[model samples]
Target chain A: MAITLTRTRRKKIHAIFVYLFLIVSSAATVLPLLWMISTSLKSGDIIFQIPPKWIPNDFHWENYYRAVTDIPFFLYLKNTVLITFFRVFAEVFMSAFVAYGFARFHFPGKNIWFLILLSTIMLPGEVTMIPVFLMFSELGWINTFKPLIVPAFFGGQAVFVFLLRQYFLTIPRELEEAALMDGASRFQIFYKIFLPLSKPALITIGIFSFQGSWNDLLGPLMYLNDSNKFTLQLGLAMFNGMTKVEWGPLMAASILVLLPTLIIFFAMQKYFVEGISVTGIKG
Target chain B: MKKLKKYEGFLFISPWILGFFIFTVFPISFAFYIGFTDWNSFTEPKFIGFDNYIHLFKDDNFLNSLKVTVVYAIFAIPLGIISSLTIAVIVNMKVKGIYFFRTALYLPAVVSGVSIALLWRWILDPDYGLINLILSYIGISGPNWLGDPSWVLPSYVMMAIWGAGGGMLTYLAGLQEISRSLYESAEIDGANGWVKFRHITLPMLTPVIFYNLVMGIIGAFRKFNDAYIIGGAGNQGQFYMVYLYENAFTYYKMGYATAMAWVLFLIILLLTLLVFKTSPLWVFYSGEVEGTKNKPNR
Candidate 1:
């Protein structure tokens, strides 16, 4: 009886330990974000108070208003939206077209081209940064969104193409064969058949592309010389001066910048989780 | 019919073909050409073969940046892998509110890089930071995390760990793919939890582990925005890529920067190949034979 009691006690301890681990790790993961929101709401004096208050006595709604007007936040938002929309649209369409080719068709140099496409995934972007910058400069495209938006149209993302290809491959060949037999051309087959089946993959790629372009800083920083052309990420980056940083405004702007992504993520959490799983399965 | 389909395939794929030629292939070739020539914004290009490469060998800042990058990668990757795997394993168990826990853990990942970096900078503030305040309660003083050079990389590492939720999610999926039968068999043999994990879970998770490792290495090398945001102008936390950027853009040492870029490329390529070669030995896939299939098209 004592042994059984001890065994039950041990199991309870194990369960408690697991719960404690989960709770602590979850807190550690979430604390910084909570702190950001907390600090953003606090007054300047309260921000620097020792034993750093987790909640503000009075929430400063003015900080958000000030952050927007202080910088060209609207312009940054406009640029980010435009860039993200067009870039993601282009990447999805182009990646689907390219991935279909690899998945369905047998063409000359197919293997070689496929290899080249995949090899780019392994090549660090830093390696091509200088030349790409120089190329854009020579074309007089610097300081414009052209450099940012143009490459995206041309099947620029290897990972997206790869993901789409894997998704396309999983689609039973019988569907395509049937479409072909029904006097459907390859384009029609792609559009009417494979395209419809690949919605999840398309959404996944769209979300990834949107998130990537919206959050990208280095590309804008490298190409755009004009402060007016700044994206949201670059605009937020400008808040950091040498010694002193405006923590309140920075956090405020950060909150503004982070909100859209978070909203999208939470709204589509299931799709995002499924998308990541699909990509990982292929990997 | 096959021949016609092949032509159609080429036509469909022409955008990528054109892109490869125009963007990737052309830019890479251009990068190679520029690496041998000295040209700032004002001056015309002057061919000076191997001079940029020669200078790179002697540059102390480049070497130090490399060291910093290596250190950052080492810490970030292992810590990311361990924490993510641990979280994944814990969450994999049939527990209540698993989805909520997963979403909470992944919330940081959806946070913007700039926002997170800014948040962490505040959190790591020596005087007023929450981290320091927490440390003080334990009678241990926290050093200047982002301010001090020694602590900056680790601070970044801590921030990276906070966002390990995506990696954790991937690992969770991998863990789910692992066969339950293996665990049951191990249990029947009187194996403890640790032994089952060591023998069964670890081996089965190797493929995902390999996947994450490759992704982590690539990510570590390309890490830029966080350092740029945190370090500001003077390159305090100037990582390797950040230094490369400064040289290329800030100083207009385009040739030297291109050389640095090439070296980084080669290092990444070598590392990727090394991982690929070594992966077959350890990465366990249940359905397919090891390495008989072609490389993944990605």
Candidate 2:
């Protein structure tokens, strides 16, 4: 009786410790973000105070107002939204299109071709990024969204194609063969059958694509020279550069820029967890 | 019919093939050529025949940046992976309110741009910055995070680890795949948590660890945006990619930049290959056990 009782008690203690560890680490994780929020709401004096006003007595909400009013917030938001929407649209659709080809077809050189596609992921963007920029420059596609958005239509990301291909391969050939028996074309099989069935994979791709393009800084920073064409990421960077050292409004704007990703993440948490596990990582 | 259908496959995958040519193949080949030239955007690339490659060794900035990147990766990779694994183990617990903990940790990873922006604001404020203020409360003063050359790499490492909770989910997926029966049997044998983790958990997680290690190395080597945005005290913050960016865009030294890029690519490839080569020794697969040759599945 004593041994059984102690063992159960030990289990209870273990549970409690687990909870404690979770609570402490979560706090550590949340602290930086909370600090950003706290500093954003603070007036300059409270912000500069050595002890730090974490929950500022003075709620200077005007920092948020100033952040929007002082900069081209709406313009930047629009530019980011447009570029992100198109990139995600093209990337998801085209990646799946190409993925279906690799998974279903047995064309001549298909193995070698797919191998080439996989090798592309091995080569870091830094290698080709310079040459790609030079190509765009020669084409006078600089200062536009062309450099950022166009290549996505051509299976721009090898990882996505690989991801979707893996998902497609899992589905039995018999599933698609039925549609083929009905005299449906290959495109029809992909569009009507494979795509609808692969909703989870497609949604995962969409979420990641949206996340990548929305948060992208380098692509926009490199290509878009015009202020009006600047994505929100570039705008935020510019806001920091232009302001020099204002933490209040900058933090506020940072919070604002972060909202979309946060919303998308919460809404589609399941797909995201699945996506990252499948892909290893975005880099 | 077989030949016709086989030819049709080309039509489906043509977009990428075309994209491969215009965006990838051409650029890669051109980049190789550009590495030997002296192009600066305004003029045609003049054949310099390995001058750029020779000059790379002479470029103090490139060497310094590479050293900084390698050093940053040394600290960031192990710490980042350990922290991520720790979080993954914690959150994998079937505790109540685990979802909330996972959400809290994972949310910051996706919040990329704003996090980068806020990292600067919170770290750079000498008196009011969160780090300094926290330090003062603890009876210690913080060094200037972005302004000090010595503190710059550490600052980036700190921020990268802060957002590493994003990696926990990948580890969770890996953990879930490990059959609970292994642990159940281990537990019945009177194995403790540490023993089960060391023997079963770590070995089972080798593939995921391998994946994360390779990806992490590549990422650390190419890490740019954060460093570029919060450029460290002086040029101390100039990472390899940042230096490459400056040479490529800012200076329009396309040839030199392309050469730097090819070198960076080789470094990444060689390192990745080295890890992969070493992986078989440490990375145990579930199916392939001791003294077996490399299996096709592996």
> In candidate 1, what are the lDDT values of residues A1-283, reduced to their tens digit?
9989998998888888888988998888887778888877877777888777788888987888878998899999998898888888899899998899889888789899888888777677776777777888889999999999999888758878877888888899998888778898888988888878877678777777778888998999998879889898888888765356767777888899989988887777677667666665332
Candidate 1's iRMSD: 1.9
Give the root-mean-square deviation of each candidate in angstroms: 2.7, 2.5
User: How displaced is residue A136 in candidate 2, in Å?
Assistant: 1.1
Best-performing candidate as measured by lDDT: 2
Against the true structure, whose DockQ is highest? 1
Candidate 1, which segments miss by more than 4 Å at Cα?
A1-7, A242-244, A279-283, B1-4, B232-236, B287-298
**Where does candidate 2 chain A have its weakest 10-residue lDDT segment?**
A274-283
lDDT of 2 by residue, A85-160 (tens): 8899999999999998898887889999999998887778887788898888889999988888999998747888
**Candidate 1 collision pairs:** none
Error of 2 at B152 (Å): 1.6
**C-alpha RMSD between model 2 and the true structure:** 2.5
Query: Taking the tens digit of each residue's C-alpha lDDT, what string does model 2 give over B88-112?
Result: 9889988888899988988667778
lDDT of each: 0.81, 0.83
Tens digits of per-residue lDDT for model 1, B1-298 = 7677658888878898898888777888888988898978568888999999898879988987888888888899989999889888988877788777877877766776677777777888899987998889899999988777778777878878887776676677777777677778788999988899998788777877888898888888888888877773233478888899898888998888888889888878888789899987888765453423222321
True contacts kept of each: 0.74, 0.69
TM-score of 2: 0.95
